[model samples]
Every structure is written in structure tokens, then in C-alpha cells.
Target: MSPNLFFQIKILANITELRSLIIVKQLLNSTFLYIGTFS
Candidate 1:
């Protein structure tokens, strides 16, 4: 693949990873809050 295309793919992968991480963090926080309320 061309260097430019490779670089673009890498950036896209990084962005996807970052988005997933944020989503996971939000899910964890909400789960904790839900359990806390029950207790």
C-alpha cells in the first residue's frame, strides 16, 4: 500500500480505538452507579 494510504488507515484505527475506550469507560461508570444505587 502507498505510504499515504497506510498513514490514513493508522489514524482511522487510532480514532476507532479511542472511541471504543470512551464508550467502555462510560459503560463502566454507569454500571457502577447502578449498583451503588441498589446497595
Candidate 2:
């Protein structure tokens, strides 16, 4: 495979990872907020 194609794939992977991390963070934050509200 070409280096350019490899680089693009790497970038796409990083973006996907970042999106997953953000989603997880949001879920955790919301969960904490819910617990705090009820506690």
C-alpha cells in the first residue's frame, strides 16, 4: 500500500478513537450527574 493511503487510514483511526473517547466521557459525566442528583 502507498504511504499516503496508510497515513490517511491512520488519521481516520485516530479520529474514530477520539470520537469514542468523547462519547465515553460524556456518558460517564452524565452518569455521575445522575448519581449526584439522587444521592
Local distance difference test, per candidate?
Answer: 1.00, 1.00
What tens digits encode model 2's per-residue C-alpha lDDT throughout 1-39?
999999999999999999999999999999999999999
Candidate 1 lDDT tens digits, 1-39: 899999999999999999999999999999999999999
Candidate 1 lDDT trough over 10 residues, lowest sum: 1-10
Candidate 1 residue spans exceeding 4 A from truth: none
Off by over 4 Å in 2: none
TM-score, candidate 2, is: 0.95
* Clash number for candidate 2: 0
Report how far off residue 6 is in candidate 2 (Å): 0.3
Model 1, position 15, has a per-residue lDDT of 100
For candidate 2, list the clashing residue pairs, or say none. none
TM-score of each: 0.97, 0.95
Q: Work out candidate 1's RMSD over C-alphas.
A: 0.3
